[model samples]
Target: MNVALIPFDTAAPSDGSGVRRALRRLPLRDVLQLAVVAKVEGTATLNDVSRELASERIGAELQRAGSPALRRRSLQILSVGCEGITTPGGWLIASLKAPAGRGFGLALGHARSAPVAMHDRATRKHIGSAATAVRAAMRRAGLDRKAVELVLIKSPIRLAGGGPHVGSTAASRGAAALGAALALGDIYESDLRDGSLCTDWRLHGFRAMAFSGTETDCCEALVMGNRRGGDPLLRVERAVLSDILDAAPLAALAAGAKAIFFKAGIGRSGAVRGARTTVLTSELPPDKQLRAAASGVVGAILGTTRAFISGGAEHQAPPGACLAAVIRAAD
Candidate 1:
């Protein structure tokens, strides 16, 4: 099976436009599922985004197009992170996975502060706090704990007017590691002591990344897995990359293969964002092929699934780090 990991930044008009445009340009014969992440400007919650999108006719459009509406699935794992900003004070990060076709749709959110401490180095603390909140949400939603796969955290440094800069690099990486550890249920107070969350690179499994110039102050998290049970409609396959540069060729090679799903992950190294990114692709677009690709990638990385590929490379993925794919699985 082949998968393509396409990245996109919903905050950017071009990125979002490109995706909408892609739908028009493509064959439109396959099943198409979408996942979107927008770094909102002020204090916004996951529900806020969901509500806004729902209110703005986006959900209606999907329904009209025969796509599924926003439905929250069971809680599996959780990841959180924080970043500093001038006007917003601080930003929060969280990712959650939801059922969509054969795979899941991973949603990432960024919330801006309402004048809280913005420069604190307590990124891991923020992530942990968010995780607790998510657990509460899960309980409210009636989701089980054992279904979670992993959690991811994306952290950025403080910047002027809440935009992207180099200051938040280390903080973002730390947040990622801490979030992953927490999602896997292995976090300790000592781990938070030296601010070792972002410093450590050995932590791998779940994927995480951070960027500057976001619009919101809330952190977002998404859970990815097969908790909804097996689907005779499709099957999924995943491949993890130790290096992002390796993802492109791998995806190209996998194109036109016999897999229903293909997904990848993107991460960073050191204080700077890594160059590699993840990808997911399918034999066709719009139907089971597209849905399977989205699900596979969501399950594979524990990140957002319906994102536009362009912004992902520019905003989510670092310079050279990227993930790509081709999907061809059994129906």
Candidate 2:
């Protein structure tokens, strides 16, 4: 089956009315499934926008204006900032900032030192702060140390010209590593001070990606679990990409003539610009065996392929390894 990626303006309405308008303008059938809807903003946080919609009762207005069938249909909301959004409808929405917002290590710099020193210093501070917060959060939540499946972090990037870049940084990366370790009870303050925080890739157990355009000044984190309690409708899966060449094989495996959605990214050590190919199949495969195989293969290929390789495995994945799939069980 063929899937198309259609871009829409999400900044106009908080309750998806903007998306609805865009959809109406499309030549496609009115009943077509919308895989994902994304919102772009120059200075807005996703959570803030969502909250604003609810707070301002914009959702009610949208509901009132929406077609009766649309109003009655079930809706699921997912959000991602600079990284982009993937929907169950086999669509991927990639959001990019203006040209001025692109650059490496844009958000991190030493108060008074060389770039390397500034990066190092920023890393230390971010890790320290995040680790503290994770520890406190875990203790308050009364969660078993191992039950925390992963500690994901979203931090701001330093852009060029005192602006913001659209990616991660040494500081944000360091914070992600430290926060994960701390959540798993794997690292101590002394360990962090001694430069053991993210110096070893073997201990990399969590996922962290920093996007620069977020409106929030403070960092944000989410603690995910593997248990079946809480929100049963939400399912999450995380997989590692062991090789870049594995992308094709993985895509084939993931597509399996089934409707599936995904997202992909390279690590800091990755090449100047990683090459990635994504496929969204329109039919659901028969079993998890094929689905898992497809997802794994694609990830492995993407991680190891020369076109998408990164050299920063010291604190991320292995030298050639990367992350690929996030499969959410159908509701």
Candidate 3:
């Protein structure tokens, strides 16, 4: 796999000029990914920079693109903005491409997060949209749902809620997972009732790693699978743990992965392994704590501080447990 990282200057203007400038940094044809991470410094807005690049498209080489550019087909962009004090207000767009091979296939798809009325009740619409996105991605890649071996589902959640938004974090993750499962036949529609989501631990989806947060408004999903014809240069391995402390599976599945993605549930009682914790007890927010703890544990093994570690573990794994998956150099 070939991945390139380009960091833009903070002084860059967010208007069309900014994107044009970024393009000047790299060749468009060789670039397959454009992930914009802008850290807000002072009063400057990274969101402004992200919004500036939103309308760009690639017409040809040297052509400035915002996103959804045509490269064999239209490309999807993941724009992430982090506001802070010292960080630069720019981006680190990566150039990612699969290893060269005739059999290699890939797919990308997304759907908005809307709460739909199902069974006379309001529920996260991610289920329906995720189903559509997953199906579309598989179809584009000429693969079946069964061929899908890994998935990453991200949804925006309300951090603080008074009534309806309570448990919004779990709600967002549950909906996304259920939607992905629908496409894979991991869970049946009969099991998706008004109370079935975020409740029934028995109704879990295999290979669907879900994360929910205040960063998004809709559900976004990325799916990767293997086809018999494709001798892929990338490999994905999965594991379902009985609990958070279960490291047996982690060692086996994450052997050679370049990256790892997993979900961990803050114990319902706000405790882990019988120790009282502050996920819901102290003044510290639970979400932040979840992120810290997740990265801490995964970092110890991967020997890198960076990985897709998040909370909202819900049905992603056993209750009070976790789900782990790795991406590695193909065997």
Candidate 4:
């Protein structure tokens, strides 16, 4: 797989300037997934349209590039939040022709859901839609349940009229993760219901890193793993953190890694490793708090602050824990 990081450089994500430049660096037709991570500016009131505007700009730029991959609508995740040391930018991950080599290589594929309705935000309909899309993405990636290393999901967090409903972002994220779990056979469909999301910690996706934002009403799924005949230069590893402070696993995995992404959770309880934490009670958004704290830990280990760390890890990690994935050169 090929990865390119492009900076926004003070430009609003809606401008499409960054994406246009990124297209030139990548083999447009081979591109499979795009993620937009921007910094939060001003009050995050209903007027914030960064996610929606960025999505449209990205789609237009991809279309203009004449990428055939758009035939299936390449997965696009537009997330707006760069808490702590995280930088505002975008990542274009694509599959280019592999040079002659003989090791397992990174493979990526994606699928998008139909627009979810307001009432279906956290309901069974939303869950089933996400599950179906995830399964389709896995099929496209030529990966089985066990072979898939990570699943990145973008779920809707806003109402049609704008703004968020009570706990909408967390609920949507939980539902998306549960859907991934169901698709990967980690959880059963019978265990799912409207109330199952954000309420049942046991039903979680081991390989999912879900992000909820105002990007789009539809759910987008990106599946990544190692497959034969892919680019042999790259490989990805995934691990679960006991908590944000669980640095030993990351220390082991960060060696030679080119990219790192993290999903942090507060878990059902407000405690971390037997210690009571106050993130849940902090006046700041809990998701922001988690992102900032996790970024600090990951940056300290990785020796860089450019890691993609997102919060609202409902049903994606163990209680008060985090999920991590590192893409690195093959041994």
Residue-wise lDDT of candidate 2 within 11-50, one digit each (tens)? 4335455455544443342322222323222123323364
Which number leads on TM-score? 4
Query: How high is the CA lDDT of each candidate model?
Result: 0.31, 0.35, 0.54, 0.73
How many residue pairs collide in each prediction? 85, 35, 5, 0
All-Cα superposition RMSD per candidate: 13.2, 15.3, 6.6, 3.3
Per residue, candidate 3 scores C-alpha lDDT tens digits across 51-75 of 3233232223223253335333323
Tens-digit lDDT string for candidate 1 (151-212): 22333334433523224533443453454445445454454554444434444333233222
lDDT of 4: 0.73
Candidate 3 weakest lDDT stretch, 10 residues: 38-47
Model 4 ranges off by over 4 Å: 1-11, 29-47, 67-73, 97-102, 158-167
| Candidates by lDDT, descending order | 4, 3, 2, 1
- Model 2 RMSD vs true structure: 15.3
* Model 4 lDDT tens row, 84-103: 88765546666554354555
Name model 1 segments beyond 4 Å from true.
1-117, 133-157, 160-166, 186-190, 204-213, 228-237, 245-331
Model 3 residue pairs with clashes: 56-65, 56-66, 57-66, 113-218, 157-213
TM-score list, all predictions: 0.43, 0.44, 0.68, 0.87
